[model samples]
Target: MKSRSASKITLTSYDDLLGGVATLEDVREVAIDELHSFTDHPFKVKDDEEMKELVESVKAQGILTALLVRPLKKGGYEIISGHRRKHAAELAGLKQVPVIVREMDKDSAVQAMVDSNLQRENILPSEKAFAYRMKMEAVKHQGVSGANSAKKVGKENKDSARQVYRYIRLTYLMNTLLKAVDENIIKLQIGVELSYLSIIEQEMVEEVHDSTGKYPSLEQAKQLRKHREEKSLTKEVIRLLIIGEPKKKTSITFKQDDIKKYFPPDYDEQKMRSIICQLLEEWSNQNH
Candidate 1:
């Protein structure tokens, strides 16, 4: 009889491990502490409702799919994907997870990581920004011919090359402004225009917005970018740009008592305002 030796086994590539006849045997149960996150992972792991649901699922049925990882030179494995899953498993009090080990280069690891995470339905703007930027750099490092890495990434992301560049530009924005982008306080087009400004210029815009409770309109962002190009973007100029002449409000005002009958008793001022704005926007769209 011959004894099988684990030490003599070697994996040539991820495809061979995952696609070959060794698929079932390639997966192993590893201690959760043995896995490390990918360096500079762009996607966020939030404990929001989605994460809560994942944790519940993991607790109820266990992790259905194995995490994809690569063995590190020193020891343990670096996670190429399943960061959120790992986090959820932790919250579910899981000490071990199933993983598939793959031998891959840095570029391959990065491409795999980006491709896997980009399939998520609710990725934030900031996540997309950094992910696109990282994938673009990895594509270049992989010796991809030509300078159109954005086009390659765009094809995978279902966007145009120009749109990919625009999203990547968001990486240049300050943290506060970038947070605003994530919160939808600043639209994508406006965020792209603002990304052209220097860090200090972006800070100036953030300060003005914080102080005045206002955001830059598309026209205002364009003007700000133009001023920045001419090297005339100062605090005062930014202030005026963001706080451009406020249009006069109509003199007519509806008293709370008068409008209260039209709304539900549970409706608050913010909810009423939101409904009004939504109706107005729909009406404007229909008319136009």
Candidate 2:
């Protein structure tokens, strides 16, 4: 999708401007040092092999696309798009890189920021969770609400409303569990279930995972949810429920010496046994 330029609104904030026209038309060389990262950027800028390739590309071909940025209230530009390109340029040791300065308000900027980044091929579940939530709020701030809000954001991201909400649920998870959800250690459904758990209960579940090496099954997660009361859901109980019920004992044996003391010395072995059974039957009859 084509990016919107800041020039649609007032462009007076810029200390440096090529023109007061389309952002696409007014590209300028911004000092790599001056461009700050997008605030609360959900996407990660990792130094992986993809970045190595981008660095080499920047070193050789220069920045192909101008970064989209808006002037911050503090006096520097906040990057709206082309975060990877900016990082690559920095790695390439370039003093200045091309940028398209635009006038974007915070809500529009946040929506645009997420819209731009969601175009990436591989976004972690956590990233989607937070990004969808941020964009949904931005949508809400713009007077979009109810089902329409999810549809507006989800339509942009190629997801259904329910799928968007499912992704957003991961944000409630503690970082450790959320990371596991990202890593696929916890299945998406299970993660959603775990999200409903209190942070302390979730921590207990994490402890169970760490101490017992048991990942929570869907049923176990449901068990956690069903027995959510703290009085009922102790750590050991969590462990037992997660690990499943213990096996039942099939047979019990008693040593002959242990039973021998209860019998009379005058009675023969067969008589002793018969008498014991008779006495047990009599006792059971009395009790019953």
lDDT of each: 0.84, 0.83
Can you give the TM-score per candidate against the true fold?
Answer: 0.77, 0.78
Model 2, 134-192: lDDT tens digits are 99999999999988999988887899999998898899999999999999999988998
* Candidate 1 lDDT score at position 236: 91
Which stretches of model 2 miss by more than 4 angstroms? 1-24, 229-231, 248-251, 254-288
Give the Cα-based TM-score of candidate 1 against the true structure: 0.77
Clashes of each: 0, 2
Candidate 1 positional error at 212, Å: 1.0
Tell me the deviation in Å of residue 12 in model 2. 26
Off by over 4 Å in 1: 1-22, 245-288
lDDT, candidate 2, at 250:
100
Local distance difference test, candidate 1: 0.84
